[model samples]
Target: MKKLSLLLPIAAIPVLVFADNKQMTTVTYLDRGNLQLVATEEPSSFARQITENTPNQDRRHTLENYINSLLKANAIYNHKEGKENPRLIYQIHANNEGTIIATRSEQGKYGVQIGNRSLPVYGINYDLQSDCSWQEQLCWVFYPSSNHQKERWLEISYAPHAIAELKEGVSLLIRNLQK
Candidate 1:
């Protein structure tokens, strides 16, 4: 009976370790021949409240436009075949966590701030939940006439400094909207 009791606590060790560091996000990039489709999400309530007085569809569109502008302002670019300056569709879904999705082709030197330290993103794995893959379109489907392209995004969790930064951005956006 004593041996059984001791083993119970030992088995709980692994669960306890993983409970603190939950799998934050999985960025899926579907490559449809010429263009890439990257999808991720943000906190839905926060996104919806960004434009409080607007209609549901309009609010989502406005949020997507705002995020796309942020991407451009940060100099993040996505490429497409046969287009000099291709404008990719920024499909920002409302979900959980602040996630950044990137493929293997994206080897840009970006830095992340964790707490007081800023570290360069050198493809260093940090409990990545799943791998991203490119899939060839097998069937023709009805895509919206207005929106059909995909854009990349950024997400962060388990990092205090990064969360603080995101909060600051959200506060600034709200303040500006109030003005």
Candidate 2:
């Protein structure tokens, strides 16, 4: 009976490890070819900026709502949402190889989560121009300037809003994912 008890604990180790690693999710790769997402942060020379005026509280709230809806839709479709961890967004759109993860943990750090490491956001660019292949032109690109590696960087794309509103949405995603 003693051997049986020892074997039971050993078998449970894998389950416990998996439970602890539940935060890891399937990595979503950005299809640059399909989306036509350019890596430039500059305003398109041919296309004019959509809006120069800053977004007010209402506008920002609306943008956040839209982004949240998109996330919820994806989560629901994938059946990844749960009562314990309701908001299962972010971390889906990692870099090309899924090394740099987008994260906003419960402690309030916002940026990419690589492996077991967390970094902070230093710079984010919002390209709001009518130059996209699709109907919408609000392109949000996040370039997290981390000291981890100069050659390696991160790009997170999702956009269509005023600069302030885009920031709000990005903040919301980064915050919600790691929770």
Candidate 1, 1-179: lDDT as tens digits = 35553432221111111223553232433344333333333324443356676664455346545554443333223343343332222222322222222211222346322221121223322221211222421111111122433221343212333333333333333333323
The lDDT per prediction is: 0.31, 0.32
RMSD of each: 20.4, 21.8
* Candidate 2: residue 135 Cα off by (Å): 26
What would you estimate as the lDDT of candidate 1? 0.31
| Candidate topping TM-score | 2
> Least accurate stretch of 10 residues (summed lDDT) in model 2?
9-18
Highest lDDT, which number?
2
Please give the TM-score that candidate 1 achieves against the real structure: 0.23
lDDT of candidate 2?
0.32
